[model samples]
Target: MSSPRASHRGPATMFILVGFPGMEDSHFRLAFPLCFLFMVAVLGNCTVIYIIKVERSLHEPMYLFLCMLAAIDIMIALSTMPKMMAIFWFKSTNIAFDACLVQMFCIHSLSGMESTILLAMAFDRYIAICYPLSHSSILTTPRIAKIGLLAIIRGAALMGPLPIFIKRLPFCRSNILSHSYCLHQDVMKLACASIKVNVIYGLVVIIFAIGLDSLLISLSYFFILKAALGLTQEARVKALGTCISHICAVFLFYVPFIGLSMVHRFGKTHGSNIHTVMANVHLLVPPVLNPLVYGVKTKQIRHRMLRAFCRMKSC
Candidate 1:
């Protein structure tokens, strides 16, 4: 026989995602633009990946890193966007407990991977700018491959424990998640059991995975800028210009995320709708904008894109 506490716990089989809590009647209106953006994100990232694959000129370290970033963006989009659209368009908000945990794993782990790739890209830039003579040898093809592999491994190993820890806790509170996705903190709050360990581990993951990556990325940019200062004016302009898309990508991914987190923690006076919308924007904007930013800003990618478009039009 189960313990009294175990018997009193809420259903462990299902979780109801409270998607856009106040937009019960506007699902259709909301779905259109979100769906459109999702399509653009998908098509754009796919095009980037394809262009990089077929273009022999883009087989360098920087473009390889951009390709990796593009692939991660696709994973991020697929992981969250489909379910979000389902909730908005079909009212299919109920997710199995295991499924919710899986979603949590994918989103968080992939997010960590994306941040890691950004750090890697920044480091690549640093090495290219600060030590140009040794860039090719330092960031060799095999070495870049290893970096990509390590990034995935780091994300998975660190974030894999989250759902397992959450699974052990008995959720006596409501199973209704406030967001359209299964976020670590949101799901942890539903647990009736002691969550001190979970909370601590979650924070540690954030600090080590995201905080450390962001710090390293900042350090890289500092070195890159320091090196750029020693170059001629034209060279300095070119160096900084190369980083514009990446800078935009980092800003898009982190700023809204930090803003949403702050609002959740301190926005007691703010409406839940605010949190909901920010959460959606946080997930949506990066994938949608990263491709556009890169496609427009990166010369090689822009030229390749134009060539591909011309071919399509000719056919």
Candidate 2:
């Protein structure tokens, strides 16, 4: 009798989703909500981008990062959502090997870039809050431009090797991924060869890239909080209010991300559904909520967005 791996070897078996044991019924329930989320995420981020572009007053370091974030969300949603929707809607989850690698590259690269941009935004806030006298000099237009370019380069450099390495892995068995899209760990598990090196590399990348960035962001906020405490009560409240949205954005992205990683690493067999939910939230929540949080909290962006919307409606 042919092994399960060999049975799935032929091109004819590609995209054959051997789903989790009891997940067949759960797919429909999950699809509608996920589709609604994808639509909202795309439209929300796009509106932020449009408002920023049309309103010149909103052209500053903070809003620039917001635009970068919106762009990243668009790319990430494009990378994962359509394919996920197709799988759910049409039951046609066929993804070519090359396409899978490309998807992995785009998803991770954009995600990494967003993290880097957030770090830069944190630094921007730190300078603005802690060194108000020198904020202009410290975070000049040219400086922000350079930081954006660096974010792109850093994201590409860090994520470039992942797809290349994954492509080289001999996937002799189990092409059917449990998750919706091609995630690093999920794809690694499908490899027939030893994945010790890939796991190690992934850990190192996360530690140096995401881990280090998050650490620095936390440190920046630590100092920011300190600076805020020194100000008068009214000023402190104002400063904290300004940062609340960013704090929410940061928490939404990192907490779920860390939770997903921990669950996948330590609690995989026990709470796999919970892990799946967290992973989906990590990928979906920030994109859907970040713009809303920023727009509602930041007075200037909110005004600009409203004006843009009103003007469009009038036309």
Candidate 3:
């Protein structure tokens, strides 16, 4: 699956992954923190997912959306963490070209999935807070299922062609990537062939997908806020309370996503350090913090976790 440093004489079948630019001497030391974060992300998300699955009381629309979010976080971590850590710990930087493409697709597609699910979560919150009586009926199991299915399809359809586009181009330039993991933009940047199509399509996907989704999410919150403003002080606080966790999650995911996308699109002159750090945050922070945010911010999850731990301790 690995090969020697590829030459630029012909098409590249192997590429070098630069774990962290300007940190060659301290990669081993740096790997520790990253590995710890990876483990926490995996375990935290898994715990949240399992808790939701086994607790019948937590099977409401809000909890269901949280579960889906946790699962997506797990997938996002799995997609990039292993190979990234391998590069850091074992110094295995050579990645097969095809495998790199798969990683790229998974990262972007899953990001799209997270963005769509966040939009859906915002809608769920909107219904629950603004139209409490219809919340249950509106976000029924079948409807949630359809949203999930649509998210999957949209992510795939938008990002699936990226790898094919990259494959069609010939990579005769440098094969060194600036980040620890494979990325669509990073991969295509190495291609000696023209990438006008890739650029346009990439922008279209970003604009229509996450960009539109964020705008809609904002609109949903605008309506939710409008409805909440009509309520009494205590009632308004209670209504907005239910949305706090989701709001935190949306910021965590979108802020980094938008920042990284902008860096890729327009930060060409920026230092590689900024790009690398931004990329790591975009890939790592949401998975690490999303479940934690939900776990701490949502009372039901917090109580359930407390009770579960108390039982484990025979308290």
Candidate 4:
């Protein structure tokens, strides 16, 4: 009989998931779509970054946040999509134990960074729309840069312990991860040892860090909306237009995230597949849609991208 550590039957059984049981054929189905999505994500985010870097007119707090967001999106895609596509296409899902922990850490760290950056953006928007005269003084270039650095540091510090904790867990069983990538919860389940501490810490981080950030973002928007309502029709329309893309992005990030958490907590067994799909969407949707949403909504970015594309073609 094969030891539990040696069996590759379930993701919970192997150090790395070689493949899924019934989903072998489904891998082929996902290959082209995943590849196409990955390319689009990378190209779209790079375009945003390029536009910010090249366009001198975009050197304000808003565009700075946009640049930070683009960078984060690139990191997000880099962390997860490459491995996922490799798994789908080449069936190379055998990530080493240490590597799996690293991947999970990177994924969650970038995700936390993205959320923090979004909150910063919300505050920037709030100041701009709610107190336009003071916005420039309050959100200078140096201050914005500092905020970006702070975002990075906060994310790294918050998620830095996850991999350490995971590494300390005894892998009495072989570590196979369900789904494509090494998510924290899935990876933790592979440990035959007690995971109450891990789970508790994870929830605490989620509640205090992500939850607090999200709540503050919502409050910022609430005040922003109230201020917008007081403006003239044209100003209100302009303000609404300016924020619509961000509002969409925020909703895209949080709604599914909260739903996934609730499902995990309350409807675990019955909603397993639903939870999985939502979790995957939570990871994929923001990176894929962020650039597109901002590009279409922000005229400056769109114009800069078009000019950049034309220049590239002419060369």
Clashing pairs in 1: none
Candidate 2: residue 71 lDDT (0-100): 88
For every model shown, what is its TM-score relative to the native structure? 0.95, 0.91, 0.96, 0.91
Which is the leading candidate under lDDT? Answer: 3
lDDT of each: 0.86, 0.80, 0.88, 0.81
- Put down candidate 2 lDDT per residue, 1-315, tens digits, no spaces: 122343432332332332233576676676788889999999999988988888888888888888988888888888888877777766666677777778888878887898999899899889888998898888888888888899999999999988777777776676767667777777777777788888998899889999999999999999999999999999999877777887888898788888888887887774256766666777888999998898898888788878878999999
Model 4 earns a TM-score of 0.91
TM-score of 3: 0.96
> Which candidate, 2 or 4, has the higher lDDT?
4
Q: Highest TM-score: give the candidate number.
A: 3
lDDT of 2 at 137: 83
Model 3: CA > 4 A from native: 1-10
Off by over 4 Å in 4: 1-14, 18-21, 270-272, 309-315
lDDT of 3 by residue, 1-315 (tens): 433544655667888888776677899898999999999999999989988998899888888878888888999999999888898899989888889989999999999998999999999989988889998889999999899889889888899999999888887667888888999888888888899999999989988998999999999999999999999999999989989988999999989888988888788564468788899999999999988898998777788899989999995
lDDT of 4 by residue, 1-315 (tens): 232354433323235553344567888778788778878888999988888888889888888898899888888888888887788788777777777778788888888888898899899899999989999999998899999999899988989999888877766565555567777777787776788988998998899888999999989989998999899999999987888888888888888788877776686573146656766787888888999999998999988878878999999
Candidate 2: C-alpha RMSD after superposition: 2.9
Query: 131-210, model 1: which lDDT tens digit per residue?
Result: 88999999999999999999899989999999999888887766777789888878887788889998899879878888
